[model samples]
Target: MRVVTGIGAVAATVAATACLTFAHPAVAQDVKPDRAIKYRQSVLRAMDYNMDILEAMVKGETPPNKEVAAQSALFVEQLSHMPWSGFGPGTDQGAPTKARPEIWKDPEKFKSLQNDLMAATAKLAASAKSGDVAQWKGDFSAVADACRNCHRSFRAR
Candidate 1:
């Protein structure tokens, strides 16, 4: 009887796991416009937080820490890739996103801005790894400029 009970429990557990696994893909595919906007906003917020920390160190508001700088740069680089795909069709207008409709209308220009951001973040990451405060500062400024450029063009006032 114990053996039978154990087998039944295992079967139940396996069935429950399979149900969740199958349900997840369907749910993920049905991502709403608002959810996509929120996801991009979350990614941007995380990048902003990391940039604030790095900016404080660069500006002497905080003590310099190579590890923090390197980690922040790497984090920013990863985050830069998260928002673009979220700028899909329904996300441009329906959601609370500041993203301009031009992002979808002017695909080439938007793509250029995305490329610029990726390049700037990549440079910042490399500079951080160098452990040179001045290089990090310069690269951080470039990254900030790239962000501002995109915001000026794509974000609402």
Candidate 2:
């Protein structure tokens, strides 16, 4: 009886795994638009929080900590590469998105802005790692500018 019960449990587990394997595509090619909005929104919010940390240090609103700034900058750099995937087709209308339709229409310009953000965030991370407060502060400013530029073009006010 024990062996029979164990085999039945194994079969159930295998069946569940097989169901999921058949139901979910390997690449997730057709994510729902609302889910895409949620995905990007979460990433953007985290990026903003980290930027706020760096901004506080730069503005003298909080004591500067090299380690904290370095970590925050690195997170910003990683996050820069993430939100673009959330802007794919059919994502403009779902959920409460600030994304402009121009993103879908003007892919080239949108891509350029994404690249600018990535570059600025990369520089900010490097400057923070170098432990130069002044240089990192400047780099942080550049990153902020990139963000604002993209928002102006592709995000609704």
Candidate 3:
């Protein structure tokens, strides 16, 4: 009876795991436009918070720390990839989003801005690793300008 019970427990666990594994992709596919907009907004907010910290360090409001700079750069790099996928159809109008319809309308320009941001963030990450405050400032400014350029064309005021 004990052996039978153990076998039943193992079987139950396996079934549950299989159910979750198959269910996940289906659930992700069904994510609504509003959810996508909210997700991208959350990602941007996180990036903004990190950027503010880096900016403070740059402006001498806070003492410069290489570890913080490096971590902030890495955070920006990761967050940059989170928003583009959220710019799907129906996301342009349904939710409380600053994103303009031009994101979907002008695909080429949007792609260019995305590429610019990626490159700028990559440079920022590399500069952070070097622990040079001057280099970090320049790289951070580049990232900021990239963001502004995208916002000017893709985001509503």
Which prediction has the highest TM-score against the true structure? 2
For model 2 the TM-score comes to 0.82
lDDT of 2 by residue, 4-84 (tens): 468798898899899788764433348888998999999999999999999999989999999999999999999998888
Stretches > 4 Å off in candidate 2: 1-28
Q: Highest lDDT: which candidate?
A: 2
What would the TM-score be for candidate 3 when compared with the true structure?
0.81
Give the Å error, residue 11, model 2: 28
Q: State the C-alpha lDDT per candidate.
A: 0.87, 0.91, 0.87
lDDT of 2 at 83: 82
Error of 3 at 74 (Å): 0.8
Worst 10 residues of 3 by lDDT: 24-33
**Candidate 2, lDDT over the whole model:** 0.91
